[model samples]
Target: MAEEELQLEDGSKKKKLFIIIIAVVVLLVGGGAAYYFLMGSDEAVSEEMTEQGADNDSDESLTSTTVKTGTALYVAMPRPFVFNVPGSTRDRIVEIKAQLMIRGSDNEEKAKMHVPLIEGALLRIFSTANADDLATEAGKLAIRESALKEVQIALSEITGQKVVEEVLFTGFVMQ
Candidate 1:
């Protein structure tokens, strides 16, 4: 009789421990779900607010240098610029596909309208670059900066504002 009572008591204790563990797991899962849903809703609300704020803001306040907005516009050249330059051993042909980054749609239109001039200026700059110089990363960067400056100057002369924020070489090949 005593042994039977001991067995019953042990069984009861095991059942109680199982119940406690199950409760803990349930609470943890529920808490995690709550946290996830709450955070997700908050982020959605914040994103909507940001969109509304952007819509409310006007473009007139944007200066030539104030491109602190979240968006950047890219305008690709219609054709690649291909030329030959003097390399260390022989003449190397270089082909470059370039793009311009501008702030607003107006600037983008202006840049598109002046594509011929921009291409001519860039080709003039690229023609002066030696194949040996362009073979290195630093040389490429220098060429890009020089091209950016020239494009900015050209656009500024026409628009009375710097239209292009950056000049990027999207594709480059040398052979």
Candidate 2:
């Protein structure tokens, strides 16, 4: 009777072990299947987005290249322009760092070739600014516009085209 009881206990333990192993195997297979499906869906979505982006790019490239001939470029002045301006209270000293935005490589080369002339033109424009006017944003914009016009005129006379599309003031200081 004792031997039969021992045999029944051993059978129950083996059955429990078998059930645990089967559960673990089922979990691993389910997890692997889930990972495979999720990864495949992400790849398909990315491929679709890439194809749509390519189509948009093709449409834009045609219109953009025709409107603008060359890539935009910036040419910086060798030194900042430092000068004095008269104010209602007293005279103030000003410094301006400038750059030129040109449309194409041809214009860039033309601008580089005539840096001295550009500097002189800008200096003349800056010298006329009033300290009181420089303190205001509108005054600063007016001065910038004047500088652009002056530079364009100067370059146009030499290069037969406005080599500079814009005059950018990168830095400004007052004391």
Candidate 3:
């Protein structure tokens, strides 16, 4: 009778232990499923937000357009001018100073129209001056300023634009 009672007690304890283990496993599986669902939704929300941000950036870039502008270029050089010297000896080396003022136009035709007058003005200066006067700094500055004014006027007439503001020394050589 005593052995029979002990066996019944041991069997009941084993049954209860198995039931507890099963309940713990089921709870763990349920928790894992819930976590996966929550993380998946978060990822989907982030992806949608990123895509919308990209679309907004593209639209903003399209709305802002760039405007094209024309540039003024430096004029070319190496043109020679000969001046008449009053007291110049045959072998005497004379210095002549001159500057060319040029303006660029948005229109090619306008630039072309001003080229002749610019060249002509420079040519006339060369025809009148001697080397001794040009050697001085003051003379050179005066010549440059005058040339610039003439070029600006000619360009204004040709291109109808503020052709030139100043003359630049394209080339300066003592010899």
Best by TM-score: 1
By TM-score, the candidates rank as 1, 2, 3
For 41-129, candidate 2 gives per-residue lDDT tens digits of 99999999888766655774311122235788999999999999999999999999999987888788889999999999999899999
Report the CA-based lDDT of candidate 2 relative to the real structure.
Answer: 0.86
Stretches of candidate 1 off by over 4 Å are 1-70
Q: How many Å off is the CA of 103 in candidate 1?
A: 0.9
| lDDT value, residue 104 of candidate 3 | 40
Clashing pairs in 3: none
Question: What do the candidate models score in CA lDDT, each in turn?
Answer: 0.86, 0.86, 0.57
Instruction: Please provide TM-scores, in order, for all candidate models, with all chains considered together.
Output: 0.63, 0.61, 0.43
Model 1: residue 15 alpha-carbon error in angstroms: 22
Weakest lDDT window of 10 consecutive positions for candidate 2: 60-69
Clashes of each: 0, 0, 0
> Which consecutive 10 residues in model 3 have the weakest lDDT in total?
60-69
